[model samples]
Target: MAFDSLGRFGVWRGYTGFSPEEAREYEQLGYGTLWLGGSPPADLPGVESLLAATETITVATSIVNIWVAPAKEVAASFHRIEAGFPGRFLLGIGAGHPEHTGEYRKPYDALVEYLDELDAAGVPAERRAVAALGPRVLKLAADRSAGALPYFVPSAHTAKARTLMGSNALLATENKVVLTDDTNTARTVADPAIQLYLGLTNYVSNLRRFGFTDADLAIPPSDRLFDAVVAHGTPEQVVARLTEHVDAGADHVAVQVLGDDYLPALRTLAPLLAARS
Candidate 1:
């Protein structure tokens, strides 16, 4: 499976212009993949440049919102990348929040249709994944695509997702990490990122499934909830928290380092994570 090539860890970043130098650095540091988030366009605008810049690192979308990026367009983009980079790109698609999507209705059915279109468009099931947060979609991803790439979830959720996905699927969990030792600093780095998801119903519902209460789901987010969802501390301590996802069931953990810059944290954690994975 292409999942094997993903090593044991990958870097997750918001969709933006990828720096060739930064990408090369990620490869040198031993991260197997660079996951682009924030729902990239159907053309997959900056992907080729990223792939061309690095030799072996897999560049994947953390998610391309199905509602925004049509199946055929995304499928064409996938083929274009495959022709040039071959096994270097992975298509990650998802049904974005109803709160944000104007035409959001029957998301599960919509996702099935999108997958069907991708199938007709000739995108291999093995080369794509679904950004699922619930059991039904998780199973859909496992049965129909590569597997689930769930976000805003804890290690406990990883264990449950693994059960639903069975044993052979590529279960890559997205984990947020703040590379700091002090509690205040960690919260300072993580709070802004956490606040956004707290308003999104999908993430809130998922957190509740894992036993978090309404208080935990507040606008500012309770410290207990923040601690559970975001791994924060020293590099070693942060790595220990991230390892929990792998130990629970994640085949690969996509580390989303929260801060002003990602390189410093990536550099510090790379060797430590390489030793563990």
Candidate 2:
């Protein structure tokens, strides 16, 4: 029942980019939570600002990277947010990519150690989640935190994750969407983001697990892989794909509207997604 607080859908954006004004608009559009990505600062004043701007929409970190944001500082910040905003903040933490972390070694062990720190610092397990992609970390997320917030994944991944995490834990999947009917246009708009993840070992490994080959991960990703990872087309068609995620066992879908402008797409899908949820 704790997962119910997240509603059926949320809006995902980079923490440094989205304004507090836009956060209010997301809540108005019926999204239940706002996920701040890009490993926000440990203090999380941006999360606080968004919470202060809105009334009830939950604010979650898509992740605060363990390497960048220390556990004690993040815990103190979580307590600060909880005091002011109460149950509106959900802490999502992760090991981040080895490519990005200079000290990255034994990520699983590091994540376990980070969780131990959070636990000692009094960050309740129910109030946090892990940015888990693989089976081992997914199970760890279920055992330690509230659940899993898996990013850049498809419904098949969601279905597999749900099987690993079981019924009690939260399964909030992050799905990217492009608002256009033309396949070529959609792929062009999404390719930059897709290309970025293609280089990341964690994302690449997860996609490989789901049957994506090295050819699919090449510079210009294959349409099959692109379509599998990103939902595109009319609002209705995109909503249909989003519904597939929900049907596949996601408790909540954090929609990342790709492209320069997020509002127009988010605005268009609000009512259509509302109807489905």
Candidate 3:
């Protein structure tokens, strides 16, 4: 697998927030990949647009939910993108949460079936990844796909994922960043950002494994829980915290900046993260 093609650090955000021109700008800023968050559709034309805009930087879906998007259609889209932009696209797919999906059932089995279809449709195993958090799914990711893309997790979870996946599989974890010095302001910005995930069992269960208690996982989330999951500080401090993920085991850190704009945080972080790379 050419996991090295995706550099050590990348940007993560909603696809709607960026344009083709903005994607080129992120590439120029030294980010190696652009992860489009949210469960995108099977026909990933937006992914194609980002690929067309950037030269070397990779563009990937944070996840294309298996329940909503059929494997055959997704495989067809993968072929379409690969024909025009070969090594620049990575398909990240996942079995979405039960609360969000009306037909959610046996996620592991569904993911296995989806992978089988992708394989039959010729979507190379090395070109795709699974959004996994638990050990069972992480092992499945390593056994079936190129890697695992875990979201709403801390460095502790990243370390666990690496141990579960073994050394060979790629471990790309998302780290939320809020650029600020004040603790109250940082948590204020980050609390609402993760409000949706706190209610989700998958994410809450993962946090529990990391030692977060029921009180910590409350509606507003304990301060310790918030701080641990979201890196909030000055630019240099945020970089330091992000580096902890790489130190723990993450091959690539997909940074999700929590603020009104993404470009400013990306610009501030580009040089610091690039220096480490």
Candidate 2, residue 50: Cα displacement in angstroms equals 0.9
Model 3, range 57-153, lDDT digits (tens) per residue?
A: 9988889999999999999999999999998899999998988999999999999999999999999999999999999999999999999999999
Write one digit per residue (lDDT tens) for candidate 2, span 1-277.
2788898999998888778899899989999989998889899868878889999899999899999999999999999989898999999999999999899999889999999999999999999999999999999999999999999987899999999899999999999999999998998899999999988999999999999898988989998899898999888899999989899999999999988878999999999988887
Clash counts for all predictions:
0, 0, 0
Every candidate's lDDT: 0.92, 0.92, 0.90
Clashes of 2: 0
Per-residue lDDT, model 2, residue 116, is: 99
> Which of 1 and 3 is the better model by lDDT?
1
Q: State the weakest 10-residue window (summed lDDT) of model 3.
A: 14-23
TM-score of each: 0.98, 0.98, 0.98
Error of 3 at 16 (Å): 2.1
Lowest lDDT 10-mer window, candidate 1? 14-23
Query: What ranges in model 1 sit over 4 Å off?
Result: none
Candidate 1 residue-pair clash tally: 0
